[model samples]
Target: MRRRLSFFACLGVAVERVMTDNGGCYRSREFNAALAAEGVRHIYTRPYSPWQNGKVERMNRTLALEWQYGRAWDSEAGKASTLPAFIEHYNWGRPHSACGGAAAHAAHRRRKQPFGTQQLVIHAFRKSSISM
Candidate 1:
């Protein structure tokens, strides 16, 4: 997970914490050490607690509905071209059910906080790295 997170670093995003289920593999000494080395807090969700995993689950469902299976992409480049638009809509246009019906960016603005962790993840869809 630590090495995988380096990809986010390449996108000018700093990952501070990660929440995952209490899987045995994630609880291993090596995994803990890796997260510690990266200065990332490893947050383990409660066992059998689906609510704790809601945010990630919701994002996956949204991506599937809005991006993956929603349209036909003529080519890789075609998909790439359209992704940013969808991401823009997702962050700035659509009202999220979980954010009191506020668009994500609007909600973030109201709170005066940085972008949501999940929203920043749209950078992963880019074909090129963006330097900070």
Candidate 2:
């Protein structure tokens, strides 16, 4: 838990909330307390509702396809040995459509901008620039 918090700090991310399935570890008092100390909130998905956690579910499916079965390994040890490289490739090199075509690592480093074309259009709409 300390390591996870430290990782987020190193990434300059103040994790406001996390959504996960109601797993035993996630529901544990110790885990919840640690997150609370960091001012983070936990949200649980309803049972058997993968769509409720759509992004994570899609990522899990992606990993199975791209890493687990993407290549033939001589042994579990071989796969484990190459896991770090695969992770690096996935985070830093691969462009994710869900991340607006940015690599995951790059996307994670970005902060939300207050102003954008969408925000500008919405501001105009609120001022009645266009009518229904």
Candidate 3:
């Protein structure tokens, strides 16, 4: 969670709040401390209520179907190696219905910043050795 927070910070995005299910990790003292240190509000969905976090749940489902179980991998390293490319394609190449048939980065660009600025940031991110 701290790493993700830092990544968003590097992207110049202020994360004011985070919503997650009532999972053990989210309830841990270390996680709460991290959120408190960052001054980010933590919200938990009602127990058994997946609808409260529908988008994340849907994404998890998609990831499971399309990536995790899509093919047989010879080793864990092989599977792990494909994640970054999958994420890149998912974010910048594939069209999403929720984004009005545009890629997620396109919708994010329209909503957040001009195309050139977003491209520059993404280019920098791609060039950097930062591993998520």
Candidate 4:
């Protein structure tokens, strides 16, 4: 939570209100006090109605499906250490059809591209895996 808070702090915006469900963490006095210190309001949703935070809930489901299930982890440490790398690839390497077949990093770059203008091209060179 601290890391995420610091990350949002680096964006230079004090959180005004955080809409969340009635999770224990959100209901904790300490967490509520922390939000007060940051001048953020806390808004809780009705239980069992996840549609209130549907975006985050859907993204969480995607992460579990796309990255977590059916994967082997040798150890807990290995899983923990690999998360950052996986997240980097998810943000930069994975192409999204929603973003017109471009990765998030690339999409951010060409966000202002003029209509009917040519955009940057990315090429991949496959390396041979076996030697004769």
1-132: candidate 1 lDDT, tens digit per residue: 755687668755788877776766668798789889999888877899958877655665687777866787677667666766886787679998868999876877788765434444322221122111
lDDT of each: 0.67, 0.62, 0.71, 0.59
Task: Please give the distance, in angstroms, between residue 40's alpha carbon in candidate 3 and its true position after superposition.
Answer: 0.3
**Position 87, candidate 2: lDDT:** 58
Model 2 agreement with the true structure over 1-132: per-residue lDDT tens digits: 666666656755556676767767778899789879888777788999979877666656666688778778788777767766875686578998967999855665574542221111000011121111
lDDT per residue for candidate 3 within 1-132, as digits (tens), equals: 778878777766777778877877678899899999999888888999989877767766666678878888788678778978987887689898988999977898678764434422211122112222
Whichever of 1 and 3 has more TM-score, that candidate is 3
Put the candidates in lDDT order, highest first. Answer: 3, 1, 2, 4
Q: Positional deviation of 29 in candidate 4, in angstroms?
A: 0.7
- Number of clashes recorded per candidate: 0, 0, 0, 0
Cα deviation in Å at residue 52, candidate 4?
Answer: 1.4
Error of 1 at 76 (Å): 4.6
RMSD of each: 7.5, 13.9, 7.3, 11.9
Model 1 spans with C-alpha error above 4 angstroms: 1-16, 21-34, 45-51, 112-132
TM-score of each: 0.52, 0.71, 0.77, 0.64
Runs in model 2 lying further than 4 Å from the true structure: 105-132
Number of the predicted model whose lDDT against the real structure is largest: 3
Candidate 1 residue pairs in clash (backbone atoms < 3 Å): none
Q: Give model 3's clash tally.
A: 0
